[model samples]
Target: MATIPEPANATVQAVYRLHEQRDAQAGHRAHLGASLIGHPCTRYLWLTWRWAHKEAFDGRMLRLFEAGRQFEARIVAELRAIGVQVSEVDANGRQWRVNDHGGHFGGSLDGAALGLPEAPATWHVLEFKTHNAKSFADLKAKGVQAAKPMHWAQMQTYMGLTGMDRAMYIAENKDTSELYSERVAFDPVEFERLRARALQIIESPEPPPRISNDPAWWQCKTCAMHPICHGEQAPLVNCRTCAHSTPVMDGAGGWRCERHNTAIDTGRQHSGCAGHRYIPLLLERIAEKVDAWDEPGGNAAVRYRMADGAEFVNGAPPHFSSVEIRAAKHKAMLADPQVQRIKADFPDARMVA
Candidate 1:
């Protein structure tokens, strides 16, 4: 066998430079949009582009993300138990690297499971999904209907990057206490077709259209740029009398406006309405409209209404009685110098109706 020399730093640098050039030429963000969601709608594509570059997770959220990693570990263990030889490769330095031309498509597998014995080596790329049973059931009931285009494209892209013939999704539904697995195979022809579409979306000046097929309401809630992509609506403000209003759970927790107080079943678990209400103020300063009304028992209320049909109300206390005023006036009249000084401290007040 002939000895081969390790590549020099100059070669590695050249490779990296090439990768950057390809990424820039392909419009990497738009490429990401196409590969993930198969949609190039300007808003959706741009939102996805921004999300791919965002680092909004905190330490607490990172800890929660480790749960999925643990699940992946368990799935690896299971694959090893089934007599499959598993090993991780330094994919970044690997030779025979798969190139998509755009440089926006590549991923290193966690580990590749290879078959033994008489059968040809079957490369397996495993993906682990950990969720409560409710979520699993919802996805199952929807039958890929609820699956995000990005998710599907992600798995497919992995297969392409790794040159794997097949991939598996091992899902553990913690709530249902059940484990499920699904196998997916790569279709080179289909992969090429998708890749072309993605490239076209990336090169085009316009965005792709909104996917009308998605039925999952949860997606709408968690999306970061939802307010910008979606339209503005009502803002939720806390109120003492409204049933939807609740006290803040902790000192650190902000006050729960009425919009957030509604029960989950009532579709109020998230504060979209309240958050949307402030969109105009956040995006641009606008003059607010005010409306006033009188209430029974000499009380009054002021309403600050926004163009979006959202309102904030403040109520006034009842007026003082005539007898009460008369007694106070008499006491002030009969006061000593010191008492008179005290009475003077309490300036006369008038009810403004």
Candidate 2:
């Protein structure tokens, strides 16, 4: 059983605060992760791949993530004690990897094991997790597939990738420190379906249809993409978020800028080029794009009319450039004479968020 954390002294509080600070500054994932691919919402997956929102966690949540990883090691030791032969590292001395889609999608296995009493001759993928007391009880009552489809999908994916027929899923109750284990059989149909979905999310230029348009839908409200998806905020400006950029056919998570005819390395993707164009769908709800025209050097000037009747142009700008539209305050600044003066006088001055 676990007890509540004791009241911290100044020194301990500083340590906790530092964890939160570090977590907040952590960068987003470069590739869509296999662990997250099991989520029900494809639009959420698409937005995440487009770098729509970077997740930040508080200190307690950060610590909980560390605890889950630590629990994996303990479970590995306990499994060995029970005569299950396990290997945490592959031939290259790394946790066995489950890779797919040219390495753009996959995750590290908790480990791989053999010699389970039920199937002593066969190998099984290992998946370890820690659940709260209530969650553990629910899992025990309903079994893994019905109780935790994400975990079930995760195991199926790992097994499918590694050519394993079975997986050993072990979960520990955080409150009671009790363990529950289940053996999962690979479902070929589900794994292929998941892989196809992942490919669709990685390659799409715009977000897939949202699971629900209603912001109040419980799932949508809790999603990280909620603000952008619901039109409360503009999508972040980056090469991946731009209409001109696309995933390269090459399996490596590489991107290409169609406007510039150049490959966009990760660094260039962060600070998108001047040619960046917002995919029209990004602003469709808040603003209807009224007109568009071609500019020199393959620039496409996009014009939009906000619901409130404010009109703005994107790239062929002596107007609001793609960068300026990112800030809600700047959206209303569109027809302001000062904006015209600034764009006219400085030619180089651009907005930053």
Candidate 3:
């Protein structure tokens, strides 16, 4: 018999490239996910909620995400195979969802199940996860609560919202194919605390305080929001980060543009209007919006004072536009003392480039 032929290396490369392309086109999630609500950094949460940064996952990372997703389906199937009664979706055939804060904050649950040896008759919120060997070892050594507080918070929120008193967390080790399961009880106090944290993130007009002022903090170093949170980088341009826009303080999960007093759908939010102005705090490191610095979170065009003591406006004729301010973040010429004087003198001129 003839031996089967192996696929060429180019085929493998092509597959990864396709993954990269798909990720490149992926849009950022609109809601603040409940799964991430437990993260200790408030500033990171706010920046993510406000589209202060964009995700640029490489092909390898994208593939890892896909692997974890694939693992979830397998885990569900295996659980059902072992005589466990599992319900992965609600009546609508959609993944069970938990919504709060006017729908601005929520997450989709893995599933619910019954028939575990410890509590055969009771139902449990199901949480599935995949971890590498090192992470798996630590999880076993420390137990879920001590080693994975975020995961603990996640299960608590799910059980509390879904009306379950307990949760089953099952993690698979990628290296050894080892499995670890833990039963977690819901904490009402922790649930309420998580609820309050979500509300605080959704309602506040400005980004929440950073966990540390030091940029070198290890946690800060690994965060996606690192550049904008610590470095001099400006946030991505979008309505969510604009001075005129804000998340509605309700369960509507909607955004509003104060300048126009109109509802902003996700499409319009991604493509901010010409009236856009950077939220005062977003540019605090580069320039200060002198006129509206005292404004809670939103304000119209205003005066700006650069670090070198030059002045300019952010809106109307003679002042730079929001786009220009973002562009200036990249080009030194935009903030040059001489150019500021030129603009001050030409008051009528505009930087079109």
Best by lDDT: 3
What are the per-residue Cα lDDT tens digits for candidate 1 across 1-353? Answer: 99687767777567556655554343222124323544424445533432222324443444446677787777778777888776655446552223353443333345666763223367666556776767778656653224544445556766776678776656778676588666667767767766666555334333344443242445544554454334331222212212233333232222344444443211232312322122122111112426545567533444444455444333432222222222233222222344335434653533222
- Candidate 2, residue 351: lDDT: 61
**Model 3 over residues 1-353: C-alpha lDDT tens digits?**
99778867778788889999887666678899878888989889888898988878877788998989998899988988989999988878988998887889888899999898789999999998889999999999999889888899899889888999999999999998899999999899999999999889888888878899888898988888887877767787899998888888567688998888899998889889867787878877667767743233443567777777766667744457777766664534665667767777887766644
**How do the candidates rank by lDDT, highest first?**
3, 2, 1
Q: What TM-score, over all chains together, does every model reach?
A: 0.45, 0.88, 0.89
- What digit string (tens of lDDT, one per residue) describes model 2 on residues 54-146? 777777788888899999988888889999899988878987976677666788899999999889998999999999998999999999999
| Clash pairs detected, candidate 3 | 102-250, 102-251
Candidate 1 deviant stretches above 4 angstroms: 1-35, 38-42, 50-60, 90-99, 116-120, 138-150, 205-222, 231-353
- Report each candidate's C-alpha RMSD, comma-separated, in the order given: 22.0, 4.4, 4.4
What's the distance in Å from true for residue 77, model 3? 0.8
TM-score between model 1 and native: 0.45
User: Which is the leading candidate under TM-score?
Assistant: 3
